[model samples]
Target: MKLTVVGGGSTYTPELVDGFARLRDTLPIEELVLVDPAADRLELVGGLARRIFARQGHTGRIVTTSDLDAGVDGADAVLLQLRVGGQAAREKDETWPLECGCIGQETTGAGGLAKALRTVPVVLDIAERVRRANPRAWIIDFTNPVGIVTRALLRAGHRAVGLCNVAIGFQRKFAALLDTAPAEVHLAHVGLNHLTWETGVRLGGPDGADVLPALLAEHGEAIAADVRLPRPLLESLGVVPSYYLRYYYAHDEVVRELRTKPSRAAEVAAMERELLAMYGDPALDEKPALLAKRGGAFYSEAAVDLAAALLGGGGSPYQVVNTLNRGTLPFLPDDAVIEVQAAVGPDGPVPLPVPALDPLFSGLIANVTAYEDLALDAALRGGRDRVFRALLAHPLIGQYAYADALTDRLVAHNREHLAWA
Candidate 1:
């Protein structure tokens, strides 16, 4: 089977490439294709791919191309990780939302919404190409705002699945924080993309679901103690979820117990600047070589594992992913993309019946969906009016200002992002 990586030059590409190459025997991929609009990035990833194959002694052809159609031809799976307008554009995606004063973190808040608006069209185009070139291929999207983009692709009628490292990574981290292995945990994750709450986590083995709440209550203090570490979802749910908890739980109940101070957003910015410099430096040939050498340990292996389980006749049950709400989330609008359990196979994704959200969780779900609709409208029409309306309608935003004042602030602060599309 052939696999194509849409954004071959991303910093994470070598890791993913190396991961798949290392797992060649299990995944059974016979060829690799790297696609990118940037020639330099294509060469960088292409070179890395060659080195990875050489080390593994695999004989598959490693093809790199700027031609999307050529790269996607006959592909079995396509993984997309593109930054459509690049970092400057991403900066705008984030910064403009923050300028408007709503919780503007990319991936969960207004910033991510802005990104979805601008990125959907590009992803759709890629999906269109994949459909035309390889009708049976599954598109694996690892792009930011994955929830939104995955929905967009599905709406456009493409075979696609959205993958996020945060959820499982959080599950693993929470299990570790509770001094147990990941397999020992049974998690019930719900809600929109990044804003999800686990709602339930139980011991994985014979004891069943009853043991979880007591365990969480018992470990809540210990879990709360690590609050500043990022990935607040697990912590909020009673274990420290992942490295991103600090950002999500900054305003949560036990945040005061955090052992460390959350780093400023500027720190995230600095890291981006460093990555930008690395990408722009002309003397980076040696860098790619070093990266290639460590490629065998790349993070995409988990995804490969999931793929193998689903396709290698392992008969792993269908898993939850992002999809239109419809009946799955009764309180949410039918059009929203919700992450929940579903079956997976050549027939494609099908959502299972998701239980109704408890009142508080349902309200939170509504708030998140309201923002998503706002971002979707903003992105589709390139207008801030819907964006502002979204904020005003948000639980958080509504708590802070009157509708008139909210619109005025949104207009005053987001003048740059709100211009005509």
Candidate 2:
């Protein structure tokens, strides 16, 4: 099978390449294309990708290109990891919302809205191009604001599914704690992307006995540390929240912490520079240890599994993916994109049944789903009013003054990205 990575120039690409190399049995790729408009970075990453594949004795041919249509042409799958405005755009997304006294995250709040606006149109264009090249090719989105982007793709009627590393990361960590294989630890992962909870941890399969309580009883503090939430909070909720939830559960504190530190984008920018320098080394054949610090833990594994499943190469039947909810969650709109465990196959992902949720988690899921609706609205049909409404709707920026100000800051910082502005 052939696979193409749209943002193959990203520093994150090497990790993905490493996974593809390591998991050859699951996804046997004959041709791997790395497509990026940034020619220089693409070559650097592409060279490292080939070396990583070679180091593992995988013979898949690696190709690099600046052309999108050509890169995806005749491919079995197209994976998107692009950043429209690069780290500079992300820095703005990470900084402006903080000025509004709100969380400056890339996937939620005002920052997330700005990212959604900038990303949605670009991703749609790529999806259309991929569809034109190969209508059967599946588009696997690893982009930020994945729910909005994946929903946009589905709305446009593209063959697509969204992938995130959060679930896989949790699976690996939880499995290690449980002293079992990662695949054996099935999470009752629910809610929208980034705003999810593990209601249960079953073994073997979805129907396996739930061992969440025992796991929590023994490793509550460690799990809490990983999520950056207090141990007491985990015990109180009886579930483990994704780290992103920290932004919502403690918005003010997160804003304060963000204000004191350099934006994550800034740190990533520095890391990218070093990573690029390292990539230039011809002798470097493996993903560096420092890349782990760059984040997206287990991203490669997740991508491999999703690609394998979608291409019929073979993968775990059940996976955590972002897809149309249909009616899995009684409260969410049928069209809303939710991140949860699903039965994946060559056709696509069909979300498994989600048990009734607590009002606490369900209420937040409903609220964010509403915000995402507005976020997608502004992204599809840009206007200051629409942007303002999305910010206003976000639980983290509910106050009118903050929403109004954040809208202005978002527009001002992202005017070049927004055609309507």
Q: Which candidate is the best by TM-score?
A: 2
Cα lDDT, all candidates? 0.63, 0.93
TM-score of each: 0.77, 0.99
Clashing pairs in 1: 230-244, 230-245, 230-246, 231-244, 231-245, 231-246, 232-245, 320-340
Q: Tens digits of per-residue lDDT for model 1 on 1-421? A: 7888898866667567666767777677788888888897677557756776776777788898999999999988888988765655555444444433444455654455556755777788889999998787888888878777877777777877776655565556667767887666656666776656655666763234634466555766554454444334444544333333344445342223322333234444455445445545544432344443322232475567556554543323445466677777877777788876556666655666655666756777777677767766666566556666665665545643544454454354435444463
lDDT tens digits, residue span 1-421, model 2: 8999999999999999999999999999999999999999999999999999999999999999998889999999999999989999999988888876888888888889999999999999899899999999999999999999999999999999999999999999999998999989999999888999999999999999999999889999899999999999999999999999999888889889999999999999999999999999999999999999999999999999999988888899999999999999989899999999999998899999999999999999999999999999999999999999998899998989999899889999999999999
Superposed on all Cα atoms, the candidates' RMSDs to the truth, in angstroms, are 5.5, 0.8
Task: For residue 294, give model 1's deviation from the true position in Å.
Answer: 14
